[model samples]
Target: MPLAQRVHNLPSYLFAGLEAKATELKQRGVDLIDLGIADPDLPPVDIVKQSLIRHLDDPDAHQYPSSVGDLAVRKAVAGWMQARFGVAIDPAMEICITSGSKEGLANLSRAYAEPGTVVAATDPGYPVYANAGAILNGAGFRALPLTPDNQFMPDLTLAEGARLLYLNYPNNPTGAVADESFYREVAAFADAHPETLVIMDAAYCELSFLPPKPPSLLQFSKNVIEFHSLSKMMNVTGYRIGFAAGQPEAIAALVKIKTQLDSGAPVFIQRAMAEALAAYDGVNPPADAQESHNEYGRRKALLEKGLKDVPGVKQVYPSPATFFVWASVDDDVAFVEHAMEKGVILTPGRGFGEAGEGFIRAAVTTSADRIELALQRLRDE
Candidate 1:
């Protein structure tokens, strides 16, 4: 009756602790303005909802789906990729539907990672990158700290021996966006190594505020595998549908691993995701994107302005893409507790990685009014 060491050795999932703290505050009658997790407040687009409704009655929707995915869904994903990033991929050979980008990431580890295999990830990054190593029973996890001096891009030189290098642009927590030149550097580095596989987590690609949205790493090199999620872009987090596209062999390997893991994403959800992707022109921003941008813009402006005058807040990190504001502080844990006591919930940066210590991450997913209230609470504290 002993648990596996892999399960026992894993660090506590970051957000679970945040949720528990929020619950404790609620029980104590504190009306909390949560700015922790990046869960969008919006619902899925009309077309996506309609597609789900139309497909729910189809008999095939109830059965287990292929591990690779539905054909139409893969085709739609290809078209979307072409339209969005001008990168063409063979749907049959390069695409694999996943329950979410996280599922695809974990499965990539299962397929390729092993003990002593080095996996390089940006510190203050999404926990999934590091957790992938833990799942492999102690794969070497290298922390490539993203510092201000480096413009928040990890130095590829530090990832020398890494077999898997994970990069997330329009980064979570930090909200830093990688440009084409940055991708060119990555491509060169990958070319130099030749054996390393680059995993680009583009979950926040569509959330860019600037024109001519973020470019795909595939535009620079085929040596990289990219993950895309509808959760952030289309506000369909509950659907748990996304895709991984890259080298055919890597896609095949992921397919082999997933075949033993679980069946594919739900058919109705995949159908809805396909319809949504098909309708995307990649020229005009979707209504959901426009709405989210405007709202996050307003909240970000308010939060930045307010933080400038707050005590203990050292710097408000620039966020041109994701729905988060990474701020440098004297002590992350202390600031989180102080903010919580004043009825505002902010995520401590240390929860992301050790390099995140002395910082805090506040999500702009809440309403402008609530963000204003949270700022007032911080000022009062």
Candidate 2:
């Protein structure tokens, strides 16, 4: 008659009421322009689609895949890392295929965190880093604040002795990115704390609009592990294909836990994702990928310009990465609720952590024309 204690320990879902309100508004014929979630609007590039279609009839697609993933997919991941970041990776020893980066990230804590020790993650970050990681595993959780003064990256030194540390760049919610210099700092931090297994969430690295592109943590740290998502980079979010690569020990630990939990991601999906990863053309993507980045950049610029005239927006955080615009407001909750009433949905920042109390993030994951209309409504209100 009751759920597990861990389920009860989970924090209340912040958007439950928002979803209810949106339903009521839509029922009343209100046209809601949702800018809340970071789901890609575009379909996967042709190569990825054709690959999946071509592989659909393979007899292997119907059978169970290796828990660590098929050799072909792992080799694709290794090649991508080398081409994209000049980072050398051994597919057999260092790569583990994951259903998605979120799964690997949550499982990193499961593999590494002990019950009494803490799992540290950047605050105002993806909730999975805390909820499904530390809390579900009965490990203590720590919020290492990402402040504007630090360019939205917490000092990794603060997480010393932690069982596992989660980091993201071209970050979600904040749109901040890290550079090679910061990664060097990360390397130093890892060296200082050998017990801490640094986990880099590189889901958005390839989607940045800025020049010089984002740097990979692998360039500087052997003590770190990275979970990358083809879903975000290839506009194939539903495919749920990603991989964890880095320190061999970290990869082995995750693969061990994953084996006990379930079989590997669907074979067809893995092969399809391999097509996408193999197509990545170094730091600057090929035609289709660049087009998606450019489109999101335009939408983000339009949203930022519109926010300049909006009533409650105090400041718009400018970072040359991610398809999100983080805006400071007097009160994030009040601002989001007011926008919802006007038929535009956004996520309040405080839902992430206390560090996000005064901000709101806008995901430019819609069409330009629809985004224009949404901004106009906000201006009108």
Candidate 3:
């Protein structure tokens, strides 16, 4: 039977052949050192795990959750926003609990993008922004190039008049970050174009290794809807707990669209996320959150050091935040193939977007010993 047209419209899977190759290698008795995907190797901190377990027995936790999320959970998220960014958010009017930022991102265009409306995003950005935000909805897309000259930040002017603008910071693939001045520029642009709505995907905001955590775009402009995820921060990816906060109109519209979709994120998971979010010590999170950064830092350092002398690697892009290290290669596709042959798995940059063509992204999700081993294999040590 033929599938829906939308299924066919999806972009090619980034790891299409890599999975099969992995299986073949495994069957042939090759042990692979994977630095492929950027999933956290750490566990959710004690606070989150305890919270989840503490609430598991409550009968209310087992019931159908509020489609827009429970009021208590929303209030917790609002409180976190206030504590972390000093930004006031109305739990009722501005915040909507989501299964994950993925759900909100997928539904954002559905709620706001009328057919043929333009959706703008950074090139070499997360694919969801292009697939869910534009293609599936039949909205026109404009790619704002993120070349090194621009420090991987899209010029706000390039996104002018777009119906919806998607921004990710401590960005995926490249790991570039935006500071206050850029956000101020974004705010000014938003003020000028009241018709365009900016969506900030702040999934990696708290994972920075440098001092002074990344600032929220909300602190600069009320014109943005920010998606916060507990996946990377709290190591709760499987829980799928995230929230969206912004203008009431946008939140309401998203909630309306969500009503027809999944029921809601589980009440217990929401409760657990709420408790964990409260553990933040104002702008800076405590030890639990910092643990991932430190460990990933070690692994990333190994990759940086090992790849430094590799003949094929042109430049190892400095990633101040996220767990992935992006490096320009002579031939991205060939680099990944060569790494696989050396028993190390990596993701080719072209998988992210056209602009990522000559690069490869290596994740630090594995243990330090494994990372070292991968490096040694690459170096023929």
Could you tell me which residue pairs clash in candidate 3? none
How much lDDT does each candidate structure score?
A: 0.85, 0.87, 0.86
> Taking the tens digit of each residue's C-alpha lDDT, what string does model 3 give over 44-108?
78788999999999888998888899999999999999999899999999999999889988897
Candidate 1 deviant stretches above 4 angstroms: 13-18
The TM-score measured for candidate 1 stands at 0.96
Report the C-alpha displacement of residue 18, candidate 2, in angstroms. 0.6
CA error at residue 305 for candidate 3, angstroms: 2.7
For model 1, give the 10-residue run with minimal summed lDDT: 281-290
The true-versus-predicted C-alpha distance at residue 61 of model 1, in Å, is: 1.5
For TM-score, candidate 2 versus 3, the one ahead is 2
Top of the candidates by TM-score: 2
**Candidate 3 runs further than 4 Å off:** none
Q: What is the lDDT of candidate 1?
A: 0.85
Q: Distance (Å) between predicted and true CA of 94, model 1? A: 0.7
